[model samples]
Target: MALIPKETELQEGLTTIFEDLLLKKEGVKKELIRTRKDFNIACDQHIKSGFQSEQDWVNANASHQNKFIEYEMYCHIIDIITDFKDIHGQFPEYMEMHRTLSQIMIKLAQDEKYELAAIAKLWVDRIESTIQEHSYC
Candidate 1:
């Protein structure tokens, strides 16, 4: 006999999604902290007041590119995170699903059809909830 649908499965999936989001939130917070520390270190090493050491090099005829490279690097990182947020619609479930879809594919290949179907339905529900949650965005 086929397994009948269960609301419990979606509830479990949502619980898992919530935990994953909390973990991701912590990770992003840690990354921000690390970036701030690195910025402070760079400021101490290269910046004198409002001017950078590289400007001194320029004054002395040194051929350094200055903080142009550093500026570009920061922009690159911001672009990457911005792109991630844009594509994921600010929902951690999008990232959670991205990470899990490969495993879901593998399970489907192994003939775990019921499990795959349940997960797909769970994902759809999560997506709907996310749309509703972020309707103002």
Candidate 2:
């Protein structure tokens, strides 16, 4: 039988991945081009290995790239959140802030100004798909 991921497992996995990426934010930004290219290749390999079909792999790769960008953006936002918490000694109402940030992400994706948008979009799609598919089983 195929192993199906639970919703909690998916959420935990995504959170862990993003947090790890956040930890690498400075390294990634300092070496943007090289790091981004390396990240893309790694994502490609991961998707290729996971999906049985070539088209599915392509789709997943695209989605993973988008999510990578989105996570990068989120990392920056996290810095701001950290500052806010430092000042107030409490977390902000993050949901509203996240909504606004998501709008910015969509705009970035629409404008096609950065490859990060594609990566972020791809990331979200794959995670969502994985969660849904696993939950159904």
Candidate 3:
């Protein structure tokens, strides 16, 4: 027979996961900031060059945008994972967690918490997109 994990065990496990994800998020955030700074410097250089090197600015802008997306995705994943751990005190199957989040989004909307509801909707959309993308693989 399989033994159930204790609450403390679950909490400890979640905490470990949270810490790891937080580290990754911080790394992404740093990269995002660095890319933004590079983009800004490129912009200044492009201006100084009388708009001669458009490619440099364009590449910097693309890098910054990619890093920003990565940072945002990490933030969303961390928030949703923390929420799941706080509510259920255990790791949830992805689909179950997604469904629960969807219900939460609806409840938040019904309660007139529009900002939070919108955030939840965004999380749900992210998760749905991830699932769809992985299903093809």
Residue range with the least summed lDDT across 10 consecutive positions in model 2: 84-93
Off by over 4 Å in 2: 1-5, 32-74, 77-104
Highest-lDDT candidate: 3
Q: Which candidate achieves the best TM-score against the true structure?
A: 3
TM-score of 3: 0.60
Residue 9 alpha-carbon offset, candidate 3, angstroms:
3.7
The 10-residue segment of model 1 with minimum total lDDT is: 60-69
| Model 1 RMSD in angstroms | 15.2
Worst 10 residues of 3 by lDDT: 5-14
Question: On residues 104-127, what C-alpha lDDT tens digit does candidate 2 reach at each position?
Answer: 558787887566555455444544
After best superposition, candidate 1 residue 23: deviation in angstroms?
A: 0.2
Measured on C-alpha atoms, candidate 1 has an lDDT of 0.45
**lDDT tens digits, residue span 1-137, model 3:** 97654544434544565576678789888999999999999999999999998999999999998778667756876777766664645555656767877887798799996755775676677666655544424
Off by over 4 Å in 1: 1-5, 48-50, 53-137
Q: Could you tell me how far off, in angstroms, the CA of residue 100 lies in candidate 1 after the best superposition? A: 23
Estimate the TM-score of every prediction. Answer: 0.36, 0.38, 0.60
1-137 per-residue lDDT for model 1 (tens digits): 97633433433444555555445445655555555555555556565555656544343332122233333333433333334343423433444554454454455547755544453444445545744453434
